[model samples]
Target: MLRPALLALFLTGATAPAFAQPPTETVPLLREIKQWVIGCDNLRNCHALSAPSGVDEEDYSSLTLHLWHQAGPQGYLRLRFDHRGEDVDLSTLLLDGKPLGLELTQDLHIELDDQGGDPEVQSFGGIEDAAARRWLQRLRNGQRLQLPGDEAAHVSLSGLSASLLLMDAVQGRLDNVTALSRPGKGAASEVAPRAPAPVLRKFTAAAPLTAEEQAGLVAAALQAVKPEEGEPEATVGALTAQQAMTVTRYDCAAYNCEFDVSSRERQAPYKETPMDLQPLPLEDAALQGSVGYDEASGTLSYFYKQRGIGDCGGGASWVFDGKRFQLSEFHRMPRCTGVGYGDWPALWTTVPAP
Candidate 1:
């Protein structure tokens, strides 16, 4: 199934410092334009990618086109091509089966990297405003984009125009000179300024839990979460009764499990509240993902994998500022186009509060 990226903000408590505020238009937006998907983050940075042709194909061999632009007068447009087979030769790139007779390296610098894990995968792309404009103009009306040698590795251009237009609108570049779809004589100064990323105050008071304390906490957490009535107790080897209980209650056999502090607050002396009062946010709150928590840093992370291969997903992390959990990082990749987790476009970022 094709997974559409869901957008939600988890606000921190009142104790968080007011170091910086997001843009007035802080709402994140995601839209599916035919075979393409576009998303704009809280800071107004927009990203669009070509969707894979088949959702059920397991090989994960597909050609993906990525376009990104930051929101501001000085922001430069960037483009990249990702392929799962091998490195792409830009000199042989084709638009509707016709060659683009232009010197690509003069305006853009392309770098090929192994992307670290799979030796068969490679990506290259970096083009500023002028090069980006020229490429966009050539591709705006095309039917298909063909890479060298690989007949199956081609991106559909059905919704390319509409996706670019939506990106321009989201970043307030419509009809302006910097617009990707609708360019005009309007000065670059007419574009909106980039919004400041929010700042988070870190808390360092958390102490690492001893082995005994950690085991006790895990038991207490499992007991607090009551198992559903009529549900048979799960059986697993090499696990204690408490561990089995945790597995059954959380369905950890199928999905991965980790600790989260948000579900249960710890008062002084390490007292835990009942599960009914504070259910796991991964299952109860609007956020949807498998959660993991680090006791040493007081950081809770949530990641939802769109598929088992883990090529696409949305994830966020928050830090506990001695009182509440403040969002520290957020990113999403709506399309399963072979983009790596580190390359996902960030929708929200934060720095340490002064």
Candidate 2:
């Protein structure tokens, strides 16, 4: 009962992005899947980058391909390499055994700067439209890229396709450019960029709940208690309170579980609805787990199993200013091959910017 109720709350309470606190020195990340990291700034300039995977910690140096675009569709591509030892600046790269000379400042405006001591940073940009398209194709098709040396190091090209699609989503152009570049390759846009952090809205309400109000809150959550399609038996838990909120958890069957949420006092619980998580821009939105609230900071958070995919899903947090909830944080990992993937807790945090 609690699971279904909470499921309904996530579905019903899901709303559009709102204005929140100011951003930090670095733009907050929207997602990190395998090697890719996607995010943007207040200026609406979006970025997508990727690095190698499957390497040990000692051998886990950093080699990333970063792509960015502004609100006007003006874009650039950058490749950055950072290691613990002396800085390594690469002028050319060999991908899948094909040696290609990189025209630094000419073809791509290059930036070689010192980031503290070790871990030198070299970035390439100022790419023309033609070159950007070409590079994207090469990276996707090629298996690996290595610096020319007697002891050359290699970086994996895994997840390059998904990273490019994320770039496309951030830029608001869904022409399937990544797929179109490579004929006969068929894969839908793997992941979508999340809505921007919403601005917080304030409201006036009672300081705490009366006994009758608490009963009504429990009643609101009970509405979502129903058997899922495959599971005939359901186990609803007792209502509990934490901070200034109340919660009820339930186990439907198998991997199906949920939690419901309500403010301690009079605010209505998120409505109940049936819809799968993931597949954003949902005709209907739903969450898969318990809703958590931090009274001191006015934050609401939850994690959910992505629709159709059991291995990975998304997590999000909102700032509740008493009136309405606004987006504060979001994360999505499309594939998690790690041990115990199903119980992976959504671990995103929200620290108000100074």
Candidate 3:
């Protein structure tokens, strides 16, 4: 089945790597958006500022762009305003080319730059949960979006053909915009109807992170928790390390959390590091994580959900049980400043103490 699917995808120009690895935030999303075609004129827009959701408004019109970039525990992630004009388009949330019905506008949570001390997050129309799920189906399966960002949104996979299509889209737009802006260095070349050009190129392979590399990132995230003490043996996600996390409660699930950490108001920008996490350390760790050991594997499982404040504005949760683990972090990547949420990656799973 996998081989047939792979072959069919190649024939249809929808191909990616067999083992497409997880990606790291190395470049800003905007940096990948070489150029944009807005409205009927295919006008080249500047400061396209941010990535906008596609609106099926009969044409490829540009919308008021909103840009966001935030730093994560290790790198960063970018999320942009889904604005295509006035109303947020739900098509942005749709599963491209899929019959599945999904709309990003189903339940939107918008956070503006400033709203007093509190950030502004407008919660409203959003995509159907089913649609979101379908959109993420490929991702959950481990396929990654190719580089050049212009490739079909959330593609199943791709190789040279996919890469060329994206490169052409980007380069073509650039050429168009350049011709328009430069307007005839030869005085008469201004109206040369822009050169009709197309360049074909092979897709280059992107670097895939190793399990150990991902583990390092996981180890860094565990350090972000600002607790007075952390379980050095705790685990989450796919990787594990000699680490530390907080102990919110020893007998939590069965014991009603006798000890509490409800005093100080939660503030964020919880930074991760290679250093051990301190329990109740900076009041910056959104919440302390706890580990439960099972004699079955002698590995410690961890669980905790936390949100950041100020610069680091996002949240994450950790869950690990020895042999297997999952480190899921969240951040408002669109507003990616030095402080952004959903920027961290979890890569660790607990192991027996040596």
TM-scores across all candidates?
0.76, 0.42, 0.21
Order the candidates by lDDT, highest first.
1, 2, 3
**Candidate 2: segments with Cα more than 4 A from true spot:** 1-66, 73-94, 98-143, 146-198, 202-244, 252-257, 264-280, 283-285, 305-311, 337-354
Instruction: Give per-residue CA lDDT, model 1, range 131-238, as digits (tens).
Output: 887888878898888766777688788899998888777766777787888887767777766666677776564444445545555555555555434332211111
Winner of 1 and 3 under lDDT: 1
Task: Write model 2 residue lDDT over 136-172, tens digit each, in one string.
Answer: 7667877776666623345566666766555454434
Minimum summed lDDT over a 10-residue window in model 3 is located at 37-46
Candidate 1 off by > 4 Å? 1-26, 56-61, 105-119, 226-249, 253-270, 273-289
Compared with the true structure, what per-residue lDDT tens digits does model 3 show for residues 273-347?
Answer: 232222221132433343343322222233343323332122333233322222222122223222222212211
- The best candidate by lDDT is 1
Candidate 1 vs candidate 3: the TM-score winner is 1
